[model samples]
Target: MSTISGAHIFAKKALLPDGWAENVAITVSDDGHISSMQRDTVPAGNSVGILLPAPANLHSHAFQRAMAGMSERRGQEAHDSFWTWREIMFRFLDVLTPEDIGSIAAFVQMEMLEAGYASIGEFHYLHHQPGGTPYANLAELSDRIIEAAEKTGIGLTLLPVLYQHGGCDRRPLAPGQVRFGNDPDRFAMLFELAAGTMSRLPEDAVLGVAPHSLRAVDEDGLTAAIALAGDRPLHMHLAEQVAEVEEVIAARGTRPVEWLLRNAPVSENWCLIHCTQMLPEETAALAKTGAVAGLCPITESSLGDGIFDGVRYTENDGKFGIGSDSNIRISLSEELRTLEYSQRLRDKCRASIATPEKSTGRVLFEKVALGGAQAIGRKAGALATGGFADLVALDEKAIDLEGREGDEILDAYIFAGDDRMITDVWSAGRHVVREGKHVKGDAIRAAYRKTVAALRMRL
Candidate 1:
């Protein structure tokens, strides 16, 4: 099983790079890429219904999955916003050991695969112990993330984050933020160590860099991170909240997005997470830069962050993608649904994301699938020869999906049905999810349960 090579797959109907086709046959070679494709072919090997290219979740904080429902309570502040939620998150993460993080991340990855995501861009930042100390190995926490990816067979773009300060003023990291703090020099060392650790994973695994956010890293640090990242993916938080925007403006003499576009070489390789606070010009300008706007609708709504300008950005031909973010929920359908619904609610109109030629669901799925793959630097998002065989199969027999064909299948899945219709998922030719569950889910869930139980007692 060391090499899951020379596999054949058939689908009743699939969304190919050209368009939808029936009776599709795909061949995966030893290197985990689609080697060939045939249409109107006889069923061979594993057969599936309504197959499509699965998307990479472009931004995830895997450790934050454990704090899903723990920060729902209203704090003493009159308004409990992302700041308040962040405080609770900081407190919660303090108790997580490397082992705990590994287990929790594995569980999160399993859920992502079952939810129909074939890959993930883990915006990992937790790099040290509870206090302000590093482990014997600087990349201990990052290695845990890699191990989790290995266990779950999720295509991972491990982004080792560089967090330099508490805010844009370059103040020292707060007590709760201590564990994530690393100067530019220290971060360089940590990144190298993490890269060495990532070599143990499969060839498809990517090591990227993230400079936490404008509030977390300075100009020199951001430059260092970009240089360190080279041509690989580079993700960062940008204007996710009003207070954050104001803070960046106060310290940097411009808004977060404006500052980055002017100061850094923002391009297709960059993924700016949560541009929910951008002005019209900023949206149009950033769209032209070819950077992906990573949206986390569920977590943004839960945190009371403002809605993103989906219609305007799309009008400008912007690239964007979805992410589970805090991992409060891992439903790929709901993420797409929430994105479209949020646009409709903001504009007080239906089909806000739909174009003249395509349905809402079709536009959402296709755009996000392609944009997500680009953000994660994965050669996927389409059933094409030479691309990664990252695919998802839905239950065509489901009541909601009955009689659906072409784009209508995507429409029904996102609107009427949910991830429950996801029957299988393959990440880089590895059939990790089968018959609606992860292959190693039971053991992963058991470990997560024990870890959470111990964490609760400590809290």
Candidate 2:
């Protein structure tokens, strides 16, 4: 039903089966899947520049986008860590109505579309009303999120989260966690209800499950949750902070990753978020498991979570994907830049993550795209038939990309250019962004501004 002819197309360039072509034409069916791709030269249409499959953001907390800059101030303690930042998050989350959540999610998804992210794996846990009370309709909040995704035209992977306890020992959830708390049975019900809602979304939408973190679920709860995931993607927060690692050790006699590897049926279906504190053995073991390391480099760096062991993990053939987790900054290029830059700074070497066969940015981009597609259980992350027609076009005339060609374009886009080069984006055959601006960016942002203004009054 739709066609896009471009100067060049990076078709299937994600390591699964990779290549590029010039003067390409891609057609999309009304069902939103790729209909056909032709490599021969074609008459140029209104569209220009290179086209490639856009990346899936493998992890995100959509509501946190509103709290992005608000949590940057120092607390009474001079030091800040994940725990301190969490307290700020708790405070910010206290005032969000389901409507507010929807507005904020739409705003963030719009930003994602503009910045070349076609889909987002939203690790949603903000269920229940404020004050820890259940809403009249348990799935009201989730419906709002699905509504946001529909309005923005970005593909959705709604990862309904299971968060039960406050720590590894199964202590009761704190008052602050009331909104996020649900026992296994209640969580299952919520999951089913959310799934029904997701069924109404565009074909590109999916439903996945997430256990909030190692500290938030007991062994039994985790096992049941994993079983609930079945063939769908299974995501979890793991070993993100030193204190979390210490707590898991004290409570379980092992590090979080070690315990998870031994206990859970982790395979390609799993996406372990922020394995930041793993030992070399743990890192290698995780890599061997075929699971994705759902790395949120910008958010991890912003929250002061330590850098992941990228070199050792990659060497062990690890799969990895990037995300905007907190969405404090939503640009995909910034996420990749921060990921490589973090490695560069840690090892005190330039281009420390590049493979012998590929340039640094090319390798990172390709791997993340594949891993992200796998993690979200989508047939995407490449420009090919049967894949979702999610593509991003970079402006050839952008200053940072003017002299770039081939993989250098990717390098400069990630390393030097941010969102400026992202001239257009299409999600499932829908042109959601044009000329570096989302179609709904201004209206959605204005709605978000109003929502945040009201939230400020409540805070």
Candidate 3:
């Protein structure tokens, strides 16, 4: 058992139905779950700064971390959309050996820990060989990913992705997509294999299923994947671009979100990523479904995706979470800043996402934490008994946070500060980051640099 006593504890702030606290001690069992939290008392043996439950990154493609800054070169003639960028991504993945993937994933997860992300929902889809040939062991790629998480100490929610086709019409996958393609039967076997591998991870880790996108799977495939998911979390890319919206409507009878609502069983367990181009009616309807809108504002902006209707979504009580999708820029505060800034640009107002009683940062942070925790199917995002003891300690001494307290501290951190202010982080009661650095940062980064050098030679 371990005990951490702090000057202030933001226990249950994100999910206890009431928010924020101070002068609390949190206890955790040897098995990594929170045992209890005592208010207004300092336990003997440990001392710390302000503490708060860390947030889970609801969506990530860990391998993309390797290609972070390499895609910025302008193409020969014209506009570069997400589709065009995907080609570069496919080319990049063609050279990633399983060892390379494990190294890069460990590096990314280490960065996530330092940035105050306790868990990751890895939306893994790079499955087979370069030419679509299956490895002798189907689970080889996924095992590397699980190994990466285990080495890094970040809580894992591995979402093995099913990519069946290139479009909604059940069109054959393009040559570049071979590595990601899987028939429903093959996908089921992979899912079972993934589950077995997940059982070998740290006790808090979990396995989930992802149907790559509406463009990648047909109606029958989607239905089968959902049934296979059972009660586990279901995540998918949906309506991320205007082109995708148009394609879904052209192929199906409706837009992606509308088609999903009509056809799929989307409930609380689902997370629809990048719902960027939704109509007001579609947005309102989605808000009622209890599914999380997995928003990656920095990545969306970097990729030229449109702004989400945050004000309207919040007014409708829609759930949402932030992610560093591409990992091009991995700062949690930057994601929050970009999310709110994008809304402000669209709405032409300051504090567009703030409610009457809450600051913009507080509202954004709390909502995303709740939404992400729910989507990942974890008892985290709050410091409470039975919750995973995944917590972050901010450097109150940081310049931007010098005089802040309560919601103002969140405001300064999100609006002005960056990951540098995140001094320490713990995942499932294990200290993985301290003094603003991940415990394994240097070693992981050195390994990642070697992998990147090899990938660059091939790319």
State every prediction's TM-score relative to the real structure.
0.99, 0.95, 0.95
Which regions of candidate 2 fall more than 4 Å away from where they truly are? 1-17, 44-46
lDDT (tens digit, per residue) of candidate 2 on 93-181: 98889899999999999988988898889999999987878788787898889999988998899898999999988888877788999
Q: Write the per-residue lDDT of candidate 1 for residues 193-271, one digit (tens) a residue.
A: 9889888887888989999999999999999999999999999999998999999999989999899999999999999
Q: How much does candidate 3 score in TM-score?
A: 0.95
Residue pairs in clash, model 1: none
Better of 1 and 2 by lDDT: 1
RMSD of each: 0.9, 2.6, 2.5
Candidate 3: lDDT of 78?
90
